[model samples]
Target: MGYLELALQKEKSLLCKRLGHKFKMASPIKTRKENRQVLYQCKICDQEAWLQWPEDSFNKLSENAEKSIA
Candidate 1:
């Protein structure tokens, strides 16, 4: 990468760390969907991450736990 690109990447990393990542759906042309998984790309850092759908039972369990704690 060129110096400007490296500097931009560094800035993005710092912004993501301080403000949290802003994620958006990746373009369909670039990724294929998989069962129970969603592809996301961070707008600030241009990094990719995955989100997996949890089973119904697991979701309910977590919700209940949070409610009880609160």
Candidate 2:
């Protein structure tokens, strides 16, 4: 898994083990920026967080379309 995914898993594991809670990630809040923002909320607790990509990323829609036509 990617670094960010691994970190999120580790955080979830820690929360499950320490506080006996579980969380679910919500859909991202769309924006024009490369760094998309998402929210995670606990299923059984009053916890919520906003997370963003660690680095900027180029748009992929055009790239995917080009590849499909090739």
Candidate 3:
């Protein structure tokens, strides 16, 4: 894979560790008029977020946890 793709995979792994669990899509993905929104949840932290397609929604939850801890 290219560097950018590799970096994104690494970031995703870090986010999983920070959140202390895996991510699950809250519902089946849907697309409408080229805009896509997906709901994601962290089982360990019970964090929920909605993010546009191709973005990392789990990172937001991990970032929030870091902020609260710091």
Candidate 4:
């Protein structure tokens, strides 16, 4: 990452620590379809992260929703 990107990341991290990350669902990647990957982008940082949909808990609310639905 460049200097500006690094600085932005640091600032976003601090903001996340204070208020938590505001994430949104990212578009699907056609190349990576091995395990039903789910991508999330942080609104504050504009960073991308991937997680396995069925295995990973995206957040506490998602976990709770799964439990209730199942």
Model 4, residue pairs in steric clash: none
Instruction: Kindly report which residue pairs in candidate 1 clash with one another.
Output: none
TM-score of each: 0.38, 0.39, 0.38, 0.40
Which portions of model 2 show Cα errors greater than 4 Å?
Answer: 1-7, 10-20, 27-35, 54-70
lDDT of 2 by residue, 1-70 (tens): 1222313464443243345565555433223344454455566765655555444332353344357668
Report lDDT per candidate.
0.46, 0.45, 0.46, 0.46
Better of 1 and 2 by TM-score: 2
RMSD of each: 11.2, 8.7, 13.7, 8.5
Q: Tell me which residue pairs clash in candidate 2.
A: none
User: Between candidates 1 and 4, which one is better according to lDDT?
Assistant: 1
Candidate 4, poorest ten consecutive residues by summed lDDT: 1-10
Q: What local lDDT score does residue 20 receive in model 4, on the 0 to 100 scale?
A: 56
Q: After superposition, how far is residue 7 of candidate 2 from its true place, in Å?
A: 5.2
Instruction: State the lDDT at 65 in candidate 3.
Output: 46
Model 2 TM-score, 2 decimals: 0.39
Deviation of model 4 at 49, angstroms? 0.8
